[model samples]
Target: MRKSYLKLFGLACMLTIVSCSLDDDRVNFQYTPLQITGASLPDTFELGRVYTVDVNILRPDDCTLLDQFDVRRSFTDTTQIRTISAVGIVLDKDECAALNDSLQDAFQFEVLYTKPYIFRFYTSDDSEGEPEFLEIEVPVKE
Candidate 1:
Protein backbone atom coordinates (compact mmCIF):
# COMPACT_ATOMS: atom_id res chain seq x y z
CA MET A 1 0.00 0.00 0.00
CA ARG A 2 2.85 2.45 0.80
CA LYS A 3 4.55 1.67 -2.52
CA SER A 4 1.32 2.37 -4.40
CA TYR A 5 0.87 5.72 -2.61
CA LEU A 6 4.46 6.73 -3.47
CA LYS A 7 3.87 5.88 -7.11
CA LEU A 8 0.65 7.98 -7.18
CA PHE A 9 2.42 10.95 -5.54
CA GLY A 10 5.22 10.70 -8.08
CA LEU A 11 2.69 10.72 -10.92
CA ALA A 12 0.92 13.76 -9.52
CA CYS A 13 4.20 15.68 -9.20
CA MET A 14 5.10 14.81 -12.80
CA LEU A 15 1.70 16.00 -14.03
CA THR A 16 2.08 19.33 -12.20
CA ILE A 17 5.47 19.95 -13.81
CA VAL A 18 4.09 19.12 -17.24
CA SER A 19 1.19 21.55 -16.80
CA CYS A 20 3.52 24.40 -15.80
CA SER A 21 5.76 23.77 -18.83
CA LEU A 22 2.77 23.80 -21.14
CA ASP A 23 1.66 27.16 -19.85
CA ASP A 24 5.10 28.63 -20.43
CA ASP A 25 5.04 27.54 -24.10
CA ARG A 26 1.84 29.39 -24.84
CA VAL A 27 2.07 32.61 -27.02
CA ASN A 28 -1.65 33.30 -27.34
CA PHE A 29 -1.28 37.08 -27.03
CA GLN A 30 -1.22 39.28 -30.16
CA TYR A 31 -0.86 42.86 -31.43
CA THR A 32 -2.70 44.90 -34.04
CA PRO A 33 -2.77 48.09 -36.25
CA LEU A 34 -5.77 50.37 -35.87
CA GLN A 35 -6.31 53.04 -38.52
CA ILE A 36 -4.18 53.61 -41.64
CA THR A 37 -4.88 56.42 -44.10
CA GLY A 38 -2.92 57.84 -47.07
CA ALA A 39 -3.06 59.00 -50.70
CA SER A 40 -1.30 58.96 -54.12
CA LEU A 41 -0.82 61.59 -56.82
CA PRO A 42 0.37 62.19 -60.37
CA ASP A 43 4.02 62.53 -61.33
CA THR A 44 3.71 66.29 -61.09
CA PHE A 45 0.95 67.60 -58.84
CA GLU A 46 -0.74 70.56 -60.53
CA LEU A 47 -2.77 73.15 -58.72
CA GLY A 48 -6.57 72.85 -58.93
CA ARG A 49 -6.75 69.17 -59.89
CA VAL A 50 -8.88 66.47 -58.26
CA TYR A 51 -7.09 63.31 -57.13
CA THR A 52 -9.51 60.75 -55.72
CA VAL A 53 -8.75 57.68 -53.63
CA ASP A 54 -10.28 55.16 -51.25
CA VAL A 55 -8.18 55.08 -48.10
CA ASN A 56 -8.51 52.20 -45.68
CA ILE A 57 -6.29 50.13 -43.38
CA LEU A 58 -6.09 46.52 -42.31
CA ARG A 59 -8.28 45.61 -39.34
CA PRO A 60 -6.45 46.12 -36.03
CA ASP A 61 -6.49 42.46 -35.03
CA ASP A 62 -5.03 41.40 -38.39
CA CYS A 63 -1.82 43.39 -38.02
CA THR A 64 0.89 43.38 -35.35
CA LEU A 65 2.39 46.51 -33.77
CA LEU A 66 6.06 47.23 -34.29
CA ASP A 67 8.87 49.67 -33.52
CA GLN A 68 8.73 51.23 -36.97
CA PHE A 69 6.29 51.25 -39.89
CA ASP A 70 7.15 52.32 -43.43
CA VAL A 71 5.39 52.56 -46.79
CA ARG A 72 7.14 51.64 -50.04
CA ARG A 73 5.97 52.51 -53.56
CA SER A 74 7.09 51.17 -56.93
CA PHE A 75 5.79 52.44 -60.26
CA THR A 76 4.76 49.98 -62.97
CA ASP A 77 6.00 52.08 -65.85
CA THR A 78 9.56 53.11 -65.09
CA THR A 79 9.44 55.55 -68.01
CA GLN A 80 6.42 57.41 -66.62
CA ILE A 81 8.69 59.80 -64.71
CA ARG A 82 7.20 59.60 -61.21
CA THR A 83 8.36 59.53 -57.62
CA ILE A 84 6.68 57.77 -54.68
CA SER A 85 7.46 57.70 -50.98
CA ALA A 86 5.71 57.05 -47.69
CA VAL A 87 4.07 60.15 -46.20
CA GLY A 88 6.23 60.01 -43.11
CA ILE A 89 6.68 63.75 -42.57
CA VAL A 90 4.29 65.46 -40.21
CA LEU A 91 1.99 68.00 -41.83
CA ASP A 92 -0.52 70.29 -40.16
CA LYS A 93 -4.09 70.69 -41.34
CA ASP A 94 -3.32 73.88 -43.26
CA GLU A 95 -0.55 72.24 -45.24
CA CYS A 96 -2.69 69.23 -45.99
CA ALA A 97 -5.54 71.50 -47.04
CA ALA A 98 -3.24 73.44 -49.28
CA LEU A 99 -2.04 70.28 -50.96
CA ASN A 100 -5.60 69.09 -51.48
CA ASP A 101 -6.61 72.45 -52.89
CA SER A 102 -3.72 72.39 -55.34
CA LEU A 103 -4.67 68.95 -56.62
CA GLN A 104 -8.40 69.62 -56.72
CA ASP A 105 -8.76 70.34 -60.45
CA ALA A 106 -5.65 70.24 -62.63
CA PHE A 107 -4.54 66.69 -63.50
CA GLN A 108 -5.96 63.20 -63.80
CA PHE A 109 -4.80 60.64 -61.21
CA GLU A 110 -5.44 56.91 -60.80
CA VAL A 111 -4.76 54.28 -58.13
CA LEU A 112 -3.28 51.71 -60.53
CA TYR A 113 0.17 53.25 -60.72
CA THR A 114 2.16 50.33 -59.29
CA LYS A 115 2.10 46.64 -58.60
CA PRO A 116 2.95 46.71 -54.91
CA TYR A 117 2.92 49.70 -52.57
CA ILE A 118 3.79 47.93 -49.36
CA PHE A 119 3.19 49.09 -45.79
CA ARG A 120 5.65 47.33 -43.52
CA PHE A 121 5.44 47.42 -39.76
CA TYR A 122 8.67 46.39 -38.11
CA THR A 123 8.47 44.50 -34.85
CA SER A 124 10.28 45.95 -31.84
CA ASP A 125 11.79 42.54 -31.26
CA ASP A 126 13.92 42.46 -34.39
CA SER A 127 15.63 39.34 -33.16
CA GLU A 128 12.33 37.49 -33.29
CA GLY A 129 11.07 38.14 -36.85
CA GLU A 130 10.52 40.52 -39.77
CA PRO A 131 7.89 43.25 -39.81
CA GLU A 132 4.34 42.54 -41.06
CA PHE A 133 3.08 44.02 -44.33
CA LEU A 134 -0.19 45.56 -45.55
CA GLU A 135 -0.57 46.39 -49.23
CA ILE A 136 -2.67 49.30 -50.57
CA GLU A 137 -3.37 51.25 -53.75
CA VAL A 138 -4.00 54.97 -53.31
CA PRO A 139 -5.02 57.48 -56.00
CA VAL A 140 -3.47 60.84 -56.83
CA LYS A 141 -3.83 63.84 -59.20
CA GLU A 142 -1.62 66.54 -60.61
Candidate 2:
Protein backbone atom coordinates (compact mmCIF):
# COMPACT_ATOMS: atom_id res chain seq x y z
CA MET A 1 0.00 0.00 0.00
CA ARG A 2 2.85 2.40 0.84
CA LYS A 3 4.59 1.66 -2.47
CA SER A 4 1.36 2.34 -4.40
CA TYR A 5 0.90 5.67 -2.61
CA LEU A 6 4.47 6.69 -3.48
CA LYS A 7 3.88 5.87 -7.14
CA LEU A 8 0.73 7.99 -7.27
CA PHE A 9 2.51 10.97 -5.70
CA GLY A 10 5.36 10.69 -8.20
CA LEU A 11 2.88 10.54 -11.09
CA ALA A 12 1.05 13.66 -9.92
CA CYS A 13 4.36 15.58 -9.62
CA MET A 14 5.41 14.59 -13.10
CA LEU A 15 2.08 15.64 -14.55
CA THR A 16 2.28 19.01 -12.84
CA ILE A 17 5.82 19.59 -14.17
CA VAL A 18 4.78 18.66 -17.67
CA SER A 19 1.81 20.99 -17.61
CA CYS A 20 3.94 23.87 -16.36
CA SER A 21 6.31 23.41 -19.30
CA LEU A 22 3.77 25.01 -21.71
CA ASP A 23 4.82 28.19 -23.50
CA ASP A 24 4.05 31.28 -21.46
CA ASP A 25 3.99 33.62 -24.46
CA ARG A 26 0.83 32.18 -25.92
CA VAL A 27 -1.39 34.39 -28.11
CA ASN A 28 -3.94 36.35 -26.11
CA PHE A 29 -7.08 38.04 -27.45
CA GLN A 30 -10.06 39.95 -26.06
CA TYR A 31 -13.51 40.89 -27.31
CA THR A 32 -14.00 44.62 -27.71
CA PRO A 33 -17.04 46.70 -28.66
CA LEU A 34 -16.43 48.43 -32.02
CA GLN A 35 -17.96 51.71 -33.17
CA ILE A 36 -20.35 51.73 -36.12
CA THR A 37 -19.69 54.80 -38.17
CA GLY A 38 -22.38 54.31 -40.76
CA ALA A 39 -24.59 51.74 -42.42
CA SER A 40 -26.00 51.41 -45.95
CA LEU A 41 -29.49 49.99 -45.68
CA PRO A 42 -32.28 49.74 -48.19
CA ASP A 43 -35.08 52.27 -48.29
CA THR A 44 -37.69 49.63 -47.61
CA PHE A 45 -37.86 45.93 -46.94
CA GLU A 46 -40.27 43.30 -48.19
CA LEU A 47 -41.73 40.73 -45.90
CA GLY A 48 -40.27 37.21 -45.90
CA ARG A 49 -37.20 38.36 -47.78
CA VAL A 50 -33.52 38.49 -46.91
CA TYR A 51 -31.44 41.64 -47.14
CA THR A 52 -27.85 42.62 -46.63
CA VAL A 53 -26.69 45.90 -45.10
CA ASP A 54 -23.21 47.23 -45.43
CA VAL A 55 -22.00 48.54 -42.10
CA ASN A 56 -18.99 50.75 -41.73
CA ILE A 57 -16.95 50.16 -38.62
CA LEU A 58 -14.31 52.33 -37.10
CA ARG A 59 -11.27 50.17 -36.56
CA PRO A 60 -9.19 51.36 -33.64
CA ASP A 61 -6.09 49.45 -34.64
CA ASP A 62 -4.90 46.95 -37.20
CA CYS A 63 -4.94 44.23 -34.59
CA THR A 64 -8.69 44.56 -34.26
CA LEU A 65 -10.78 42.26 -36.47
CA LEU A 66 -14.48 41.87 -36.99
CA ASP A 67 -15.84 39.21 -34.69
CA GLN A 68 -19.63 39.50 -34.66
CA PHE A 69 -22.61 41.80 -34.77
CA ASP A 70 -24.52 42.32 -31.56
CA VAL A 71 -28.14 42.63 -32.61
CA ARG A 72 -30.75 43.04 -29.90
CA ARG A 73 -34.46 43.33 -30.49
CA SER A 74 -37.06 44.67 -28.13
CA PHE A 75 -39.73 42.05 -27.63
CA THR A 76 -41.77 44.20 -25.33
CA ASP A 77 -42.65 46.70 -28.07
CA THR A 78 -44.31 45.95 -31.38
CA THR A 79 -42.25 48.53 -33.25
CA GLN A 80 -39.67 45.90 -34.23
CA ILE A 81 -36.78 48.04 -33.24
CA ARG A 82 -33.36 46.44 -33.40
CA THR A 83 -30.34 47.81 -31.65
CA ILE A 84 -27.21 46.71 -33.47
CA SER A 85 -23.55 47.09 -32.78
CA ALA A 86 -20.28 45.72 -34.04
CA VAL A 87 -17.97 43.68 -31.88
CA GLY A 88 -14.31 43.08 -32.67
CA ILE A 89 -11.53 40.85 -31.47
CA VAL A 90 -8.51 42.76 -30.25
CA LEU A 91 -5.27 40.83 -30.05
CA ASP A 92 -3.40 41.48 -26.85
CA LYS A 93 0.02 42.29 -28.22
CA ASP A 94 2.76 44.77 -27.46
CA GLU A 95 2.81 46.25 -30.97
CA CYS A 96 -0.23 47.21 -33.05
CA ALA A 97 -0.53 49.28 -36.21
CA ALA A 98 -2.83 52.24 -36.40
CA LEU A 99 -5.72 52.23 -38.86
CA ASN A 100 -6.20 55.18 -41.20
CA ASP A 101 -9.42 54.06 -42.89
CA SER A 102 -12.62 52.46 -41.73
CA LEU A 103 -13.65 48.88 -42.44
CA GLN A 104 -16.90 47.80 -44.05
CA ASP A 105 -18.76 44.52 -43.51
CA ALA A 106 -22.05 43.06 -44.59
CA PHE A 107 -24.85 42.15 -42.16
CA GLN A 108 -27.59 39.91 -43.42
CA PHE A 109 -31.01 39.53 -41.80
CA GLU A 110 -34.40 38.30 -42.86
CA VAL A 111 -37.53 40.36 -42.60
CA LEU A 112 -40.14 38.36 -40.76
CA TYR A 113 -42.55 40.99 -39.53
CA THR A 114 -44.56 43.37 -41.69
CA LYS A 115 -44.17 46.28 -39.36
CA PRO A 116 -41.39 48.79 -39.83
CA TYR A 117 -38.01 48.14 -38.26
CA ILE A 118 -36.21 50.87 -36.42
CA PHE A 119 -32.50 50.12 -36.64
CA ARG A 120 -30.31 51.95 -34.20
CA PHE A 121 -26.59 51.64 -34.77
CA TYR A 122 -24.20 52.43 -31.99
CA THR A 123 -22.09 55.31 -33.26
CA SER A 124 -20.03 56.60 -30.40
CA ASP A 125 -20.05 58.15 -26.95
CA ASP A 126 -21.27 61.64 -26.33
CA SER A 127 -19.62 64.39 -24.33
CA GLU A 128 -21.10 63.03 -21.11
CA GLY A 129 -19.85 59.55 -21.88
CA GLU A 130 -23.28 58.44 -22.98
CA PRO A 131 -23.76 56.12 -25.94
CA GLU A 132 -25.11 57.78 -29.09
CA PHE A 133 -26.83 55.88 -31.87
CA LEU A 134 -27.76 56.52 -35.49
CA GLU A 135 -31.43 55.75 -35.78
CA ILE A 136 -33.01 54.81 -39.12
CA GLU A 137 -36.53 53.62 -39.74
CA VAL A 138 -37.32 51.42 -42.71
CA PRO A 139 -40.88 50.70 -43.74
CA VAL A 140 -42.00 47.27 -44.90
CA LYS A 141 -44.08 46.46 -47.95
CA GLU A 142 -46.31 43.43 -47.96
Best by lDDT: 2
Q: Which segments of model 1 are wrong by more than 4 Å?
A: 18-29, 36-55, 59-142
The window of 10 residues in a row where model 2 has the poorest summed lDDT is 73-82
Against the correct fold, how does model 1 do in TM-score?
Answer: 0.21
Which ten contiguous residues of candidate 1 have the minimum total lDDT? 97-106
Off by over 4 Å in 2: 1-17, 21-23, 75-78
CA lDDT scores, all candidates in order: 0.35, 0.90
Residue lDDT tens for model 1, 70-123: 333334543222222222223122222212111111223333433322323221
Q: What lDDT would candidate 2 get against the real structure?
A: 0.90
Residue pairs of candidate 2 with colliding backbone atoms: none
Per-residue error at 57 for model 1, in Å?
Answer: 2.8
